[model samples]
Target: MILIIAKALVKDESLELFKREALELVKNSRGEDGCIEYSVYEDQEKSSVMTFVEKWEDRAAIEKHEGTEFFKEKIGRLISYSENIEITLNSEVL
Candidate 1:
């Protein structure tokens, strides 16, 4: 399995727009073939920070997800709103 954690720090003025697009991305990604789980959360302490936590069947599954139109149209817009972004990937140690 593959696990991913992504964090985005959105500009204050762009929060509403970012949330709208992100919601659409999450709703669609959860329905993908190899998506075991997918979710996005806003940090109460840091209002402009949003985190995405995902679990996929494997690396290939994640790669396919990255190529989807939802990724291009919705997630792609998020970069413009974010001041900074970070991502972490993990798998069980063999």
Candidate 2:
């Protein structure tokens, strides 16, 4: 299994635009074959931060997702509007 946590810290003024782009991507991503789970989350204390939490069957699943046009375009737009963004990947310890 593969787990990914992608976080974007949007500028205060760009939050709405980020939300629109992100939600669209989320809706599409959920239907993918290897997508166990995909969703957007917001920081409770920091309203400007948006997080995408994803679970996939394996690395191939994630790579397929990254290759999609929708993911590329949406992520590019989000990155442009964000102050900072980072992704973390994890695998089961056992």
Candidate 3:
């Protein structure tokens, strides 16, 4: 299994729109093949800070998701709303 963590510092003016798009992204991604889990979170003290946590069967599953039209579109939009972003991948310990 693999875990993906995407953290972003969103622009203040784009907060609402970012949440809307991210919600749809999470919902759609959850239904994809090999999607073990997908969720989004916000920092209570810093609303502009957002995170996306995803669990997949493997790297191939993540690649498949990245190739999806909605994924491409939404991710592009999300990135546009962010001041900065960081992404990391992890492998589950056996």
Candidate 4:
């Protein structure tokens, strides 16, 4: 399995728009094959900080997701509006 933790910092004024876009991304991501889980959440202390927690069956699944048009479009829009973004990938050691 593969896990991805994606973080994005939005401008305070762009928070609402970021939430809406995030919800749409979650909905669409959940429908893709090999997507084990998809969720979006706001940081408790910083409203402008948003994170997406994603689980996939494997690296191939994650790569397939990256190639999807949905990811391309939405991620592009997010990059345009977000102040900062980062993605981290992990896997079980045992």
Candidate 5:
């Protein structure tokens, strides 16, 4: 299994737009075939900080997800609304 953590620092003026796009992303990504789990979380202390936590079957599943049209559209728009973005991929050791 693969775990993906994506964090975004959203621009203050763009929060509403960012939330809308992020919600759509989470909602659609959850329905993908290889998605074991998908969710977006807002930081308790800092609402402008958001993160996406995902579990997938494997690397191939991630590639396939990246190729989807919705993924392309939403991610692009989301990037535009963020001050910075970071993503990390991990494999379960246990």
Candidate 6:
């Protein structure tokens, strides 16, 4: 299995727009093949910060997700509102 943890510090004025785009991305991604889980959350302490916790069946599925139009369009728009973004990928040890 593959896991992805992503965080973004969004512009204060752009938070709502970012949330809309992100939610659409999450909703669509959850229905894709091999998508084990996909979720987005807001940071309690920082209204401008958002995070994504994701799990996929494998690297190939992750790759496929990256190539999807939904990702290309929505993710691109979402990042435009962020001052900084970080992503980490991991595989289950077991």
Candidate 1 clashes between residue pairs 3 or more apart in a chain or in different chains: none
User: What root-mean-square deviation over C-alphas does model 3 reach?
Assistant: 0.6
Could you tell me the lDDT of residue 45 within candidate 2? 100
What range of 10 consecutive residues in model 6 has the weakest lDDT sum?
Answer: 70-79
Candidate 5 residue lDDT tens string, 1-94:
9999999999999999999999999999999989999999999999999999999998999999999999999999999999999999999988
How displaced is residue 91 in candidate 3, in Å? 0.7
Prediction 3 TM-score vs. true? 0.97
Q: In what order do the candidates fall by lDDT, top score first?
A: 3, 5, 6, 2, 1, 4
Model 1 scores a C-alpha lDDT of 0.93
TM-scores, all candidates, are: 0.94, 0.96, 0.97, 0.94, 0.97, 0.97
| Residue 43, candidate 2: alpha-carbon lDDT | 98
Cα lDDT tens digits for candidate 3, 6-94: 99999999999999999999999999999999999999999999999999998899999999999999999999999999999999788
User: What are the lDDT figures for the candidates, one per model?
Assistant: 0.93, 0.93, 0.97, 0.90, 0.95, 0.94
Instruction: Report the error of model 1 at residue 34, Å.
Output: 0.6
Q: What are the root-mean-square deviations of the candidates from the true structure over C-alphas? A: 1.2, 0.8, 0.6, 0.9, 0.6, 0.7
- lDDT, candidate 2, 21-76, per-residue tens: 99999999999989999999999999899999999999999999999998899889
CA lDDT of 47 in candidate 5? 95
* lDDT of each residue in 18-74, candidate 1, tens digit only: 999988888999999899999999999998999999999998999999998779877
Give the per-residue lDDT digits (tens) of candidate 4, residues 1-94: 9989999999878788788888989999999999999999889998889999999999988889989998998888888779999999999899
Off by over 4 Å in 3: none
Which residue pairs collide in model 4, if any? none
Model 1 compared with the native: what TM-score?
0.94
